[model samples]
Target: MSPTVDHYRIVPELTVPGYASDALKAIVGATHAAVQANVDNLGAGTPSRAPRFVKLLRDKQIVDDKNQSIATTNHNETVSALRDIEASMDVNDEGVDSSTYGTYSVAGDAYVDIEKAVNQLQGTINDAENAPGPSVDAAGRQYWPEAVEGPLRTACATTAATVEQRMWDATTDIQRHAEHINNSAPDNPTSSGYGGTTAPLTTPWSGHSYVPPADAGTIDKIKGFAANELGVAETGTNHVNRPYNIDDAWCASFATWVWKQSGINVDWSNKNYVPSVWSDAAGKGWADSDMSSARPGDLVVFGGQHHIGVVVARNGNSITTIEGNSGDAVRQHTYNLAGGNFTGVIHPPAKTPVNA
Candidate 1:
């Protein structure tokens, strides 16, 4: 037997025969259709628990909190852009005389703005769909049962590609009509916005082009503190003279010290135990599993939840961390993110540095 396939609305390409307003109306309809298709793909109207797609988005850190979902946020942004485009157009026949009809035109910038919004939404959808889902242990305990999530993921991908392409085609329709319209449109505006950022620096002492100064934020200051202690070693034997007055394992202690020195308040009692500190950070909504966007100074819990370190830099799967007791000394080491030991990344509380 064959499998069932759900059919969705396919927005047709716009063809403006008379005025730019004609094209604008078609584009607006296409945008709305795209929005509806995404909503359906994400299972918005379902009566049960949140759909697996929504859960995956939250798990991947694409959506920051449990209350927000990827589809609804993009839907709202795209709809807002459509409303602005509509408002900028002359659609009413209020008081214009029959002899002199108002020019049916939209601001070229308005069309460009909508195009940008759609392009952004498309990229967001692609990222959420491609991000790695939650992990499952060998005991077969799943974060989300694959039986439920697998089909949803496949369907969402198909719908996203179809709807996002429709949205892009709407932009193309705008460009084709704008050439004939008197409004000032950009010359060959691509689907991409502005330009892409440079890759992160891999070597130590090499500065990142996108990063602010060490004193710019609390996180940077924490990283700066760790970076300053890169070669400090234990003064006594058997981890006795660990820095920060730590008695035993100093990884968590070093992490806490960096946090405090950078103006972040952590539970001093949780300083020695890595799991305890991880739990505390999780309770504060600071623990995240999205390693791809992990920021410098994020406390990384790893090695079977036994060790912790401050992230100094990351590029792709490579993470550079400065640890307090890797070889009885403060040293920089690299770790692959694909390794299962990378438990979580804790984002310390954000604060303005006194020097900034």
Candidate 2:
């Protein structure tokens, strides 16, 4: 008896385009295996071999047909979707309508929240764009742009120049004043030390200048008294009354008279001896033996304390003096330290004594 062959038919179903070719290949392989098994059993003499071969061939053809149908459907679906997108994108200057793309209206609360976020973002951008101008740090230093810094620098430079100019003006004024003091002369004939013109003979001297002390008023008073007596001789009626006659040595008397007129009290009052002035200064601790330590208005004792004069100015080794009895009248004289005529200097108190 012949064995019965059960023939199973494969029906093609609609599959996704991606898996259609793989499914078709699997169906063809199964048909080929079934035909191979039937032929191996039937051999060349069996009539069933041709029928089984035809059936396998028919199954492979059906799977190929199904694969083609699936490919065509997928292509059509893609074309339809693309055409719908193109139609929706069709615009004519009138902006995209909500109808063609799909209506999308934000909820009221969500719209308000998004608007607030956008405003905050805009505020941040504005702050970044419009920043503050130049400022100063806590350390009192200025940090500024070149535009502001330029004017400040110029102002500082201008102020500095002005200050320098003022300093130069002050210096010139001081020099002129020194010259005036150096050139001044006594007006009266009896005031000449040697009974001649009381004007200074040498050119105005220059050297380190010093600040006049508070009692400089006393010096001014002494100078004024000496100037008032200029050109008057000891024999003249304007001379101060002394214990001795007008012809005797009046230098010491004249110095004491000037001091008296200036309201200054000294031990050598109404006395003609010059050494007494040095003694008084020594007793009072107002004497300076060093000539270089002498300042204007100091009493200059000369000829080993034989003569005394008021110092007008000091320039290096030279000193200008206003003296009485120099050539028999009040006069201005310039003396050199090298001459060894200057013995000592007597310093007057800066303030007059209240009692004396």
Q: Give candidate 2's whole-model lDDT.
A: 0.44
User: How big is the positional error of residue 92 in model 2, measured in Å on the Cα after superposition?
Assistant: 99
Candidate 2: 10-residue stretch with minimal lDDT: 91-100
Candidates' C-alpha lDDT: 0.47, 0.44
The residue ranges of model 2 lying beyond 4 angstroms of the native Cα positions read 1-216, 236-247, 353-356
Q: Could you give candidate 2's per-residue lDDT for residues 217-308 as a string of tens digits?
A: 76676666655555443455325333323454566667776776667767552266565466556646778888888766677776435567
Q: Which regions of candidate 1 deviate over 4 angstroms? A: 1-215, 240-243, 350-356
Kindly give the stretch of ten consecutive residues in candidate 1 with the minimal lDDT sum: 187-196
**Clashes per candidate (backbone, < 3 Å):** 0, 20
What's the TM for model 2? 0.36
